[model samples]
Target: MRYADRLAELDSCMLSDALDNLGLPGAVAGITPIWQGARMAGRAVTMRTVPFDGRRSTRHLGAAALERAVDGEIIVVEQVRPEGAPPAAATWGGLLARAAVHRGVGGVVVDGACRDVDEIRELRLPLSARAVVPFTARGRFVEAAVGEPVTIGGVTVEEGDFVLADGSGVVFIPAERVDEVLAVADRLAAKEAVMAVALEEGAQPSEVLGRTYEEMLHDR
Candidate 1:
């Protein structure tokens, strides 16, 4: 799951195709990059937030996750949403983005909403989430757990898993299948590279794209 540099070399579509070839579930749905040119990959460290009660929390929402994460690791937050809770609570914001950059975090993926889109963009932090809301989580949500499995885009994500987020979307790689998926994705990327060159060399669309693309997807 520590294949950040290698994973970043490929796009989400290539990775999704690789996952399909392996018959695995990793493509996260309903979430996307919060800014233009967003992309990052790293080991995951999760933090879950729940509805806040009157009781005070010893630490802030993302503090524990950041404290536990190392360089080239991403923070995954599960912001649970239910009725009667704050209607506009966001799981991430500007401060967290700054802290993440300072902590050397590769990026952040939230299951729920995020705020401070402009500030986060200014910091150039890689943030991918479901929505961009202007509400604060302070009075509505509190950190409930860390380093635990949480759902992101309906996909259960665990600590130490691989996370790849980009302009297309986010995809979580199972910790055990990182090498397998990477190998297939690399092969597909190489084939596509050759195809691109052929198309540039005046090869007809049908000639260059015979059946190799579909064959590769199924033949693995």
Candidate 2:
């Protein structure tokens, strides 16, 4: 099945559980979607950026990754900074959001900050980030690399890895394990749907979900 189709069938929770069942780690922490219903699923186009030093060359932050990304690929950016230091600028913003939409990019996930959130919301692109800052990337940072592995919120994302993001959060699926993860996620989603129906029909949550949840997780 197409990645988008598979993503439509699962949410971050289901995929995260699937990853856990497979003993994999892909749940990103501290990154929240910018909009209430924002969601995306696509291959990753990873990039890394570092705090700017006056002597180093500056490229339009994220330009390389955006330019190279194919349709339906989400940009995953990792901000490189000194340990314990927070970023002083936005790594993503409105212009990039518009550009990504125009290019048919699925969305963007930043391990740092984003700005022009109002404009981004108007553009209606799915975005997840650590914080919001008003500063621009012009002199605050530079793109260090594109199409490479980048760590976002403690999760390692590589180019072409499956990226699924929604209100619950973002999760990455290793490119090689996409099929396996999807299979388990599908099963879990089906079981969860059954449980949801049972609850609506007056079954107690603990009785219908608690015991069955453990059994489903361990099954197969």
**Model 2, backbone clash pairs (residues 3+ apart or across chains), number:** 0
lDDT of 1 at 131: 85
lDDT of 2: 0.86
- Looking at model 2, the pairs that clash are none
Q: Write the per-residue lDDT of candidate 2 for residues 54-136, one digit (tens) a residue.
A: 75664578778889999888899999877777767899998889899899998999888899999999999999988888999
Look at candidate 1 and give me any clashing residue pairs: none
lDDT of 1 at 84: 36
Worst 10 residues of 1 by lDDT: 80-89
Count of clashing residue pairs in every prediction: 0, 0
Error of 2 at 137 (Å): 1.6
Q: How close is candidate 1 to the true structure, as a TM-score?
A: 0.93
* lDDT (0 to 1) per candidate: 0.88, 0.86
